[model samples]
Target chain A: MRNLLAAILFACAAWPAQAQLSIEITGAGGQRIAIAVAPLAGEGALLDGANASISAIVRADLERSGLFRGLEVPRLVPQLTEASSVNYAEWRSRLADTLVLGSVAARPDGRFEVRFRLYDVVRQVALGGVAYTLTREQVRATAHRIADYVYEKLTGEKGVFSTRIAYVVKRGERFELQVADADGANEQAMLVSAEPIISPAWSPDGRRLAYVSFQNKKPIVYVQDIEVPKQQIVANFKGSNSAPAWSPDGRRLALVLTRDGNSQIYLINPDGSNLQRLTRSSGIDTEPFFSPDGQWLFFTSDRGGSPQIYRMPAAGGDAQRVTFEGSYNVSPRVSPDGKNLAFIMRDGSRFQAALLDLNTRQVQVLTDSDLDESPSFAPNGRQILLATIIAGRGVLTSVSADGRVKQRLTVSAADVREPAWGPLNK
Target chain B: MRALWIVLIASALAACATTQTPDTQPPAGVEDRAPGATRPAPGTQSVPSTPVTGVDLSAGRPASDAGNPLRDPASILSQRSVYYDFDKYDIGDEFKPVIEAHAKYLREHGVVKMLIQGNTDERGSREYNIALGQRRAEGVKRMLLLLGAREEQVEAVSLGEEKPKETGHDEEAWARNRRSDMLYPGEY
Candidate 1:
């Protein structure tokens, strides 16, 4: 099996297309921040015919976060810019807690410069403003950055709007690995094949993606850079090779290989050297995940007669079962803070995404859907992106950690699944 | 574009030539009397003699051998799928004869290789299902090894829940999807 023919890899040429996913929110937030995003004065001529306006993108990003409510910002005689003065009394009457003002101007070098400022309506003070000069290809990213700025200033937490997401889209016999914005916009295809592609994972630096592709007639773990054309088959051993997870430092990877009697966790370098088996289970042991602190390894195993999540030292050691309430719980994903574990727990016959509080050992089922799998936490650990079958079609959904706010992402023509939220852009 | 067509056509012709050339002798079938032309048993089990849908055996045997036991709809070797219950990998007693027949065939022919692909229904975690599917295939592989088949001649792998024969979410489709399909050489 190791000496089989190399897979016929196909790189997609069409990318940066329209947003493949349309998001629908179904819940409200507690203590919502009412923010008003006014239209940029000079953006009409520059960003005409674009998919969305700058203000609209920023407002949508903040509203979908489940922590902010977008208030209507009426048109003014003179549109607001970074240098515009805010009428505190008027905004206060409109029930706006905060205001966002911006303007887009054409730079001398043929690029566009976006300047945005945030205002604290309650305090009647002006927050700081920043400017970003970017090419035409970066209009949406600039808007997300401005939203991130406001989110960080108000919520006092890192924003995930500017981060990217990776998912798989299946249309008939074609399978495409796509990268898009966190809001499911700016879709770009990286790899396309006739076989199935699943289990997409992002590197720590957000520069490379490691996923399992079955184009070679069997599952093989392959790592490919986001912008590079070439790819490397990191694990194509004799038996199956799958479930690739990168370490925090990006030096090593924890993957499952079946070369030894059955499925077992193995650690290997990115270049496919220094292979080490970390589990000695007679039963199946797979789906290895690393903690944020890089101290423990959480994986799913059937060693206890049923599939359950287990944790052990990052280096091979004794294992301890983490879930006991439900007979079936798997796909353990540790939060960014290492305080919670997100996995799929079976409720009767329905499978749902659930979160476990590591301190109290309390498990909370996040969704009440049927056949929900692949629970992936946002980089900030606020929301989980999972795949569920809705109306007989595979759709991706984002559910808050508290199970209060929910958003469903669907494509009109294709089936999307296996979502992996990339890390925040540094 | 013309060069690409030439390459496609050349590969197509090469594929035809490879299928026509049956270098290795035909594997031991249910009937051990003939090499290429073998007769099927009259009545093996309660399974219908009709060929199973989606079980394509055209590539497994040479075109000239029309009476191949593996391709005959009435032969026990033609039944390739072993179904299982929910979350279970153990072989049922009803399917033991089918497995025994294949194991006998493998034991007789040393040059023949078999590939067992385990699959599952779409539920729960996909990676865990992959592990479950692997266990299913490994169970069949162990059974074959115990029945006198060489370990080196059998390769067991899991397709997980990726390739489902039936797409419904009901129990009928789930039962059909949770199966291990046995493929002979040149069929995979």
Candidate 2:
């Protein structure tokens, strides 16, 4: 699996202009739907290459989702780029449930006109068709958008292809906070420092990142605008300031501050005003995360003699313990639907990612790694991205919510940690 | 900009140290037989007594006569680190004497200040480890204060798993990493 991922990364770097992430699914939750993506026809050479690149992206996206399987294209079938030209019988005979056909044309204004149609091969009918005008820079994004449409239409759930992921990477003495596509493509480092950087949390709107940096020999929380490169310290108290979690509303941050003599949870505005203490426990209180509805805050505390997850009102009140099975549970993150809680649980001496069904109160460990931490649910809540140690080095791993499918995202010689899946772009 | 201010404050502190006679409170159980045992001159501040027992200071040693106990291997203050159990921050009874020695040293030397940096093994979540490490440091600080160390003499901070005493992943390495190291200013 590692070798295959390395080959894909090498291929991507070999062709930077048309580079796309190649995902290899390590596991599947259940049966996958068979789909066929026909090679698109184009009016010019540029359009033809664009068509093939876009189709590859869409196919990769759908296949990586583990919900669809791409059917092998036969040599006899001619390339079809429109619903009118597609032979539904040919796709149906191949056991494909769905067929995607698209055409690319060069517009006079230098933009590309891309049209695509999704067909239900079983019913022999076109489900939908859409047209998009995009420039060269927007082709990749537009392809992802098209994939999102197809995925949502087929699975009846919102697609997270358009979402971004933020993570921290440490190489030698340099530390960087980076944002990239959910597939680990198009990585861009937003902040770099000689000191360690950890806990990169995204704002709800995906416009900024709040993270902890030790640039000045002490942990300080800083919120940096993702687009503008401007940064301001949101929490730099007298003592350690770390673990910045954004509220669902994006107006306030729930962070861990030791300014009051011990580690405790606090709330501060984005502009660093109106600081309010949330937990007054003598035992360490940290890793405060907000629920989807912005009503309750889930945090980790050691007040019960061991660290466990607890939930309390957002306005600070009595907190109720949530985990009992494990003596060590921390880094609680709620699913998008608020029906599940993902955290790191200690199994024997190894730490693994575990998910708790909020309704049934049943917990299931999702990872097998010996050291897993900082589990963040995807925007769609189908996968949880976490940092785990493999062969003594930190790497990012994404596991299916059901603990079946898993993917390891390695960054060569760098140690990557603290993955924060951003919200959907739209 | 912040570095400049820090330097300014440090120099200001250095200038504020007036060469007055040292405090007259002799070490515990020791008689005032030394030539410097004379009473405090007018307007001079007297040093607080070392309330801790078991120290024989009848040799007429000055309050600061220990000559930086932190560097003396035989001094309890030399044992800078206090270790704890796995995921546990509360200081064990075995480490109490170590804290007491440092507390006594702090009380005797009013000008001495130390930073208690807490650390943890690289097992749990990093941020959570940071908080746990802070509690460990604070646990030592609280013990020192309870044993008569002034509040300003100690500052507690946590390094989480960033600074590991041993890089190994086994219990031996973890045991050493899960500790609070007392560092005099500028030592780090």
Candidate 3:
């Protein structure tokens, strides 16, 4: 025992830092997915002494998917010993779909190991056993990776918990652009300014963003390199300047400008050159979006009165009107499939994100909740991220295209609006 | 483009100066000039700028008698709006006869009001289309006034893409929506 102590001390003195990465995999297949994260129990237990508990972090990761309802118990550590052996039948009766067991231990050198095991309750099988070892400083990152693995195993879906979501939060006259973990954890403001920002679109590579800014006292679209947090105005057109929709290739953007005495459509490169006009109309033409295939561009106009949707060639051609059933229609976003389209339908003053099935010409209302706008599709096209009002506060929301999961992201209380989900990891 | 803007402004200002008198103006420079004759044709006198009276702006006619407020109100059943190819705003030959008959009504009816609601097929932004429809309606309004309709009796507004006479996602619906609707002041 004395030798073990000295060896640990000597190792600590000779090494940079003791480290490990712990991962918790959730169980799948009919058995409720299990996760085992317990609060640090012993004295001087490594993590900020249990503030952001490992168990709570893991639980939030599982719960936020609108999947994996968690196990509600007084404590998870009670089941650590065999003395509390697997009370299988009792657990089954308790409706525990899965069980997570884990413990955190610290070394004398300050190195720590968060070991966890996932068990399938119905099958009486262990799904995975792993340990995340890390120096005292890196516990949070370890917890996130564990969540990612468990999410991947159970849902066959890539875990976005380890990813980040950027949003524009409007506060009176000022607006804050914030970045937070996909689960709404660790939110921090990137830019705060007293200006209007509309049409925040993520580039295909995800390192840059393009948005319309009123910083010039006029509407000008800017391409912001997120890594450097640098903002450069790419378009400053005469008359109205708004609605910057990025091409799927991420090389160009479609926007509206009234430089010719009428609001017309123009495509500009991200570097602020090669400006090309796509529509020459005597009416108001705005809100241009390129099809995912990059063949056609869709937009909204009032040439026929009120507001309706129209399509034109991205390279410029005859403009064709699409929406006729409604008195007012605007802000069309084409789905990635080059099939269905999602747009904002205005019935009187109420605006909702409505979906159009190209095959059947059927319209589906994807959101019935309060004043929602700017619905954007996830990379998978199965879900949409948008901004909606919650408890009198503007918050980010996600609804599947089928309208199944209506989840409100738990970001800061600063009126978060205009959510644009980035593309999957390249 | 800057020169174009100047030309447009000058023409608009010029239009403001040439207000015809509401008299027995035979369309002022009322020319049965053969088609394809450009304005100011080589020493040809432009209409002497006469005032027009007793003309229907919607039906484009003079009053049947003195002080007649109502236009002849000819049945416009066969008088249909001519559709243009895509972006062309000029009326085709098929529509000349319609405009001629409509112009005759205005020359006879002393006082009449007409609203030409311009339109476009749904394919672009609602705001942009509204502007396009305005141009189309304004273009039609200009043609009617040039043919002798009173300026005060004609008003043009663009409906954009809101109303369509046909229902389909094809050429037929598009062709129908791309023309102006002649609306009587009190009629839907």
By lDDT, who's the top model here? 1
Summing lDDT over every window of 10 consecutive residues in candidate 2 chain B, give the lowest-scoring window. B38-47
Question: Best candidate per DockQ, number?
Answer: 1
Candidate with the greatest TM-score versus the true structure: 1
Clashing pairs in 1: none
Please give the DockQ score of every candidate, comma-separated.
0.31, 0.20, 0.05
TM agreement with the true structure for every prediction: 0.89, 0.83, 0.57
Query: Alpha carbon lDDT of residue A180, candidate 1?
Result: 90
Q: What is the C-alpha lDDT of each candidate?
A: 0.83, 0.79, 0.62
Candidate 3 at residue A174, lDDT? 53
Q: Candidate 3 — which residues are off by over 4 angstroms?
A: A1-46, A49-51, A73-91, A101-119, A125-145, A293-296, A311-324, A335-340, A389-395, A409-414, B1-188
Give the alpha carbon lDDT tens digit for every residue of A283-330 in model 2: 889999999999999999888988999999998899999999978999
Q: Over the stretch A203-273, how does candidate 3's per-residue lDDT look in tens digits?
A: 87787878766555445678887777688878876434667788888889888775665667888888889
Ranking of models by TM-score: 1, 2, 3
Least lDDT summed over 10 consecutive residues: which range in candidate 2 chain A? A13-22
Q: Kindly report the fnat of each predicted structure, to 2 decimals.
A: 0.54, 0.49, 0.12
Scoring model 3 with DockQ, what do you get? 0.05
Candidate number with the higher TM-score (2 or 3): 2
lDDT of 3 by residue, B5-114 (tens): 66655554443232322222112232332323311111112122343433534344433334433222233322435455444466666566566656666766658677
- For candidate 2, list the clashing residue pairs, or say none: none
Please, what are the lDDT tens digits per residue for candidate 1 over residues A139-159? 788889999999999988889
> With candidate 2 superimposed using the best TM-score fit, by how many Å does residue B65's alpha carbon deviate from the native?
17
